[model samples]
Every structure is written in structure tokens, then in C-alpha cells.
Target: MSTLAPPVRRTLALTKANARLLVRNRTTFLYALVMPLVPMVIVFASGGASDAAGANAVTSVLLMAVLFPVFYNVLSQVVTRRDELVLKRLRTGEVTDREIALSIALPGVAIALAVAVVTVPVSLVAGLPLPSNPAVYLLGALVSSVVFAALAFWTAAWTRNAEAGQMTSVPVMVLAVAGTLVAAVPDRVAQVLEATPGGAMYELVRTGWYGAGGVGDAVEPLVVLAAWGVVAVSLARRSMRWEPRV
Candidate 1:
């Protein structure tokens, strides 16, 4: 008679199993843990504690943390499990569909959260200024993780296999990175890009973490991110496949 709800217990069990599998995959595990730290190298090399540098560093860290661990890893796991018939088998069990999907997603989401937590201390050690709005920064990270995870499921809907993920993942990856470069683009184009998922992420960092503007300034980006998350989740629910694409 466990005190935990049945769903929680089942989801936890599934998550533990999935986490073990992820750990056994040395390549992906290493990528999820190490790749996000790569941006720290750039921050160090630049040798500047300027506001712009700090903002860029924070943005890059958040982006990398979510992109690989939360987004790509989830995409890969979903595709692999579906192809292996693991998802299909799970569906025949006591676990619900949402539980199965969440279990697959939880491991990556945990890793992303760990990285986000480590980032603050690392930033201080690197001589970057503390985020003026730590609450917003953390909220942004949470939103980013959920948004990317949903996007991964949507992407996995069409992904044939883990190998095909490499090609299929490019568009979303590009969209994410493109947002961080909005400052370099023309104003008109930047406006459009700002509405994109990546663009919204950058905006959150700009107004929330960097404190470039007031709380009101953070509203638009938050709304943009929320919209993306809703859309991605809806699409995933509709299109996600339990069986491998033949």
C-alpha cells in the first residue's frame, strides 16, 4: 500500500527504467551532460563581464541545456521506443498514454533542470552578474523545457527512426538558434522572428534574466512561449504515433 497515487507510482517506475536506458547510452548521456557547458568556454574566452556578454552567456546556456537534453533527447527516445515497440507494449499495460509519454520525457526534463540549477553558480564563478530577476529566469527555463519537450514529440510523430531524427530535427534547431541572432537582423525580420519559439526564448532572457526592461516588457515573450507550448502539445497529441512509421 504505497502512499503515492497509482499514476505517480507507475510513472516513476517507467521513468526510472527509461533513465537507466539513457544512462546505458554513453554517447547521448555524455552529450546531454556536457554539451550544454560548451557555451561557458565561449564566455571565458571573451574575457568580458559586460551586460551584453552576461546576457548572451545566460541565453546560450539556457538554449543548449534545453535543446540537447530536453528536445533532442526526448525526440530520440520517443522514436527509438516507438520503433522498438516499447511504447506499443507499454500501452497494453496499466500505464496510461500520458504516463508513458511523461515517463519518456521525465529523464530529459530532469537533466535539463539540473543543468539550469548548476548554471547560476557557474555564472557567478565565471564573474557574470547575478540575474536581476531570478524568478523570471527560472520560469523561462521551465517554459523552455516544456516547450522543447512538446516540440520533440511533435517532431517524433514524423521521425521514421532515431537516425532520421538528425535530418528532421534541423528545422526546429535552426528556428531556435535564429532567435538568438535577432539583434543582428533587420527590425522587420526581427519582429517576425520574435514570435518564433527561439525568438521568444531570447526575449525572455533579454527582459527577464538580463533585466533589460520592466516586468511589463516580459509579457509578450511569455505569451509567445506559452502559445508555442500550447500549439506544440496540441500537435503532438494529434500526430504522435505509437507504432513506428513504416
Candidate 2:
């Protein structure tokens, strides 16, 4: 009476499900659209355009704002949804576990990439330059999005309810704000932040823009991120619950 979906078809369906949900949620749509732009607006108004010192901080803030949703918010929701039976339901159908997880993440990547494309023209119009080395920036975005999504999936496994996804992801938000302060605060603080998760994203992006050779400073954080990625993916496989509690 019924047929099974191919793995690729299953993956596409899940990815579509993820994107549609975000589109339908008015609050989420607003947050995704406006949040990333807020930091850049604030930085420019706060005099970030005045000097090189401010440039590092501005770059960090802008990227973090973009990353928060792509990484923390979306990934955390993926985790929570799994616990709530959304992922489990899909499994009873045609999707494999890998397909489900990858699908959950694909929407965020697409949205973030879209935002990057749109933001570029707007940013250049507003005085930001086209990055001389676009590869590193693109690489940084891809890496950060994937890494954080995995972390959120792991975090959601431990989270009790869907609401906790927001609370649990707070550390990420705080760090993002702190990266912005790198413009206003002392050098040591910003440098220290560069060693954290999204912290290195800021560092890597700045290096891409200016070619100042400072991206090396982010190597330590990059290693830490990769290590975290391994742990998160492993945890998701071993501990991820694919069925609702009976």
C-alpha cells in the first residue's frame, strides 16, 4: 500500500520541513532577519569605522550576530525537537538518522548563506569593503555553522525541554556580545575571546578582510572547535534519542 523514500529524497524532505517551520514562525523569521544586522548597525553608530582597532571589534560583532541563529538557536532547536519526537517520527518513515540531522542543519546553512549574500551589498553600500580574501570568510562561516549545530544537537540531548534551548544557548549569545566589546575593551580580553568557539570566527574573518596575518592567533580556538565537533557528533550518534519516551 506504501513505498519507501530514497535516502536523498528523505533528506530533502527533512530539510524542507526545517526551513518551512522557521518561515512560518513569525518570531523566528524576525529574529533571523534582524538580529544579525543589529550589531553592524550599532558598531557603525558607535564609531567602529574610525580606526583599525575598531575594525577588529566591528568585524567580530557583525559575524557573531549572524552566527547566533545559524549555530546556537537553530542547532539547539534541532536537539530539542529530537527529544520531543519530531526526529523520531521522521525515522519511522523513510529518513535515516544521518539524513535527519543533516536536514535539520541544512536550512540554517542556506539561510546564513543567503544572509551573507544580501548583507554584502548592503554592507559595501554602507562603507564596508569587499573582503580581499573571501575564501577564509566563507570558510569561517561554514565551519562555525557546522560546528555549533553539532554542539546544539548534543546540548539539546541533555536539555529537558524545548525552552531550555534558548537558555542553554545563552553562553553563546554572551560570547557574541563580548566579541563586539573587543572594540571597546582592552586587547587582552579580545585576544582571550579569540580562543573560544565563535571567538575565533571573529578573528578569522578579520584576517580575511585585512590580510594582516593575525588569523594564526585563532589556530588554538580552531583546534578546540574541531575537537568539540568530534565529541558532539559522537555524542549525537551514541546518545541521541530517536524515539519519544513511552
Candidate 3:
């Protein structure tokens, strides 16, 4: 018998199968692979001369990576599989709900991480300063990926179909983008935005990559992200659909 835990084995198998399907859908795969890198144009355009500019560029790239590859992709895949009865059938088997969802989400998560890894070298090559605290930067990337993945699953619950994902995904995207614009917003609004996922992520990138503040400054954003993750997971568990919405 395989020594690996049953959940791990099942999740790995499902992830492999899903990854194959993702690759076969050349359009989605291409978007996942390519879209995250588009914001690097910011780095090059600004000449990456200042620490603040480097942090902004990296934040933009990471946010785009999580938004499209992790959040949107997972939302589309989950909705499509549910509509197709794939998730329904899988639920009838030995796989647990958590395993199934994790499996479905893993590929996109991997893509987001790959983009993060590439960002380091790309930042270096672009004349950007090194991260002041690599640990905080890494934690931010990992937590952001999880938070967005959970949000995607929650969003998938209401999505009518894969086609509807584009429309359904807009609110979160807007929130994420708005978080990045804190500098442009009023102080009261910026405070509220800072508590949002995008705002927290932007703060993390700034603190982590540019030494904007010490690790102490990461506490609030980390807490905000943790709260969002908890809420999103709870909602997804309560509302996630197995069969089509009908």
C-alpha cells in the first residue's frame, strides 16, 4: 500500500488530472503563464531606480498573479467542473470535500508561486533593490495566494457557469485594485482599504521588499489577511455547490 496519506495521494492525483486539463485548454494556461508577467513592464518603464518604485512594481506583478492565475482561474475551473457534473461525481467517491477543492486549487497556486520566484530574479535584473526581509515577503506571497484561492471558491458558489466567472469576479478585482490606490485615496478611506486583502498585500510588499517599516508593521496586514482567509473558507464551506446551480 502507498505510505502517503490518503488525502495527500488523492489531492495529488486530482491536481495532476486538473493540471492536464488546464494545459489542454491552451488559452487559460497561456493566460496563467503570461498575464502575471505583464506588470513587469512597470519595473522596466520606471527604470526600477528607486526602492519605492521597485516595491510598487513587485506588488503589481504579485497582485496580478494572484488575481488571475489563482483567483479567477480557480473560480472558473470550479464552476465549470460543477456545471459539468465532475464535482458532483467526485463527491460520490472516497475523496473528501477539502481534498477535492485543494486539488482543484493547487495548480493555480503553483503558478502564482512560480511567478513569485521569477519576480526575484526579474527584480534583480531590472536594477531593483533586494528585499529587506525575505521571510515577510515570502509569507505575504503564500498567505495572499491562500486568501485569494479561498475567495475564489466562495465566489464559485454563486457563479452560474464558467462564462459568468468573468462578471462575478469583478468585485474582488475592484477591491484588490482599490487597495493598491491607497496613496491616492483620503486617509479615512485608505485606512479601510488597508484592512482589505489588496491593501494588506500592498502593505506587506512595501514593508517586505523596500524596508518601508520593520516586521512590526506587518502585523496588522497579516491579521487582516488571516481574517479574510477565515471568513472566506467558512463561507465557501457553507455555500459551495456540488452540482450545477440549475
Candidate 4:
């Protein structure tokens, strides 16, 4: 019989356990599955427009598909785990902190990836054009996931518990949801939102989908995302708690 490496086995077990927990948790279920699906189905049923605007609309919906779960669901799980002493116990085991964090993040990441994959065909069927630059869109999606996951961890440091997670998560969620719709607002508002972390992600994916801008267009958003990542990582490293607060 073949034997798996110790690290691999541990990661698999942790991921599997977390995945099951996510599935069983109704809140995670709604965010990961039900919430994303509602918008997707709405977009699909609307039979997307046949223009650049239509394509942008599709892009926004797809971004939401990735954002909600990765942002909210992961935030809840991380804060809940920490408050319940799950992360503390895991830290005492052979598992590294990195492994534990990744395990906690795995379920939401899987859901985001699945939703993103389903978006392509759904957009096509809804009459949106295929991404003119697939690589750029894919890269944007990846960067967004990583940035949001880092932010989730950073936010969880102060979240206290799963119930408080909803309150703490509001600022970022509003930023993301508003960022996706900023174009519909006035130029001044759009410009302001564009400087936000979610705005950077929304612009990156939208620009990538339309292939409207040159390399210069991609550079700014990439820099914005990187900046957020750095800040979130630094803060999370400094303040994230493994033990429940008294």
C-alpha cells in the first residue's frame, strides 16, 4: 500500500473536515451556494444585452459570484473557529499555522472557484461575449480572491465571534458591492470607489473582460491590489488571534 506524506495527509484531513463544516453550516451554505446563485440566475434569466455594456454587466455579476462567499463566509468561519478555540487546539497539533489558515480558507476558495467556472458558460448563454483576454480576467479573479481572503483574516482579528463577524464585515462588503456598480454613478463617485480595494478588483476584471485598456490600465489596479494585500497581511500577522477573547 502507498503511504501519503504526513503533511499531505494532515492538510487533506483538515480541508475535508472544514469542507464538511461549511456544508453543514446554514450561513455558509447560503453565501457559498444560495446567494451567488440568485444573482447568476437573475442575470441568466434576464438574457444579457448584446453590447459592451451587457458584457460589463456580466462581469460585475461574475465578480459578485466570487466576492460574497470568499469575503463573508470565510470571515465567519475564521472568527468562529478562533472564538470556539478550534484554531487554538489545531495550533497545538503537528499542523503549521499556514496549513491551518489554508484549511480554514479552503471551503470558501473552492466555492468561489466553482462559481467562477460556471460564470463563463452562463455569460455566453446570456449573450455576453467571451473574454477577449482570458489570462487577464483569470489573473484578476485570482488576485481578488487572495486579496479578499487576506482582508477576511485581518478583519477577523477584531471580529470577536461569528455574530460580530457580520457587523465587522459591513465596511468591506459595502465597498465591494458599491465598487461593482460605481460606473453607474457619477464620475466623481466612480473615481473615489476606483481607489478602493474592491474597486481595483472590479476594474481589473472588467478591463480584462473587455480588453479595452492597454497595459497601463492593468498596472494601476494591480498595484492597488498588491498594496491592499501587503497591508492586510501585515495587520493579520500582527493582530490575528488563535485564542478566544475573554
- The TM-score leader among the candidates is 3
Off by over 4 Å in 1: 46-49
lDDT of 1 by residue, 133-182 (tens): 87887888888899999999999999998999999999999988888777
Ranking by lDDT: 3, 1, 4, 2
For each candidate, what TM-score against the reference?
A: 0.95, 0.80, 0.96, 0.89
- How well is each residue in 1-246 modelled by candidate 3, as lDDT tens digits? 899998899999999999998889988888788899999888776554666566667888989999988998899899999998999899899999989999988999999988888888788777787788888988998899999999999999999988888899999899787788766688999899999898898899988887787999998899999999999999999999999997
Per-candidate Cα lDDT values, in order, are 0.85, 0.64, 0.88, 0.75
* Tens digit of per-residue lDDT, candidate 2, span 185-235: 678887776556656665666666655576574466567557767876787
Best by the lDDT measure: 3
For model 4, state the Cα shift of residue 226 in Å: 1.8
Predicted candidate 4 versus true structure: per-residue lDDT over 1-246, tens digit per residue:
549988878888998998888889886777778776666665565465534455446556655655666777778888888878889999898999888878877777777767766777887787666777777777777777777888888889888788888799888777677776656778898888887776786677666766667545888888887888898778888988888877
Question: Where is model 4 poorest over a 10-residue stretch in terms of lDDT?
Answer: 46-55
C-alpha lDDT of candidate 4 relative to the true structure: 0.75
How many collisions per candidate? 0, 0, 0, 0
Model 4 TM-score, all chains together: 0.89
Candidate 3 yields a Cα-based lDDT of 0.88
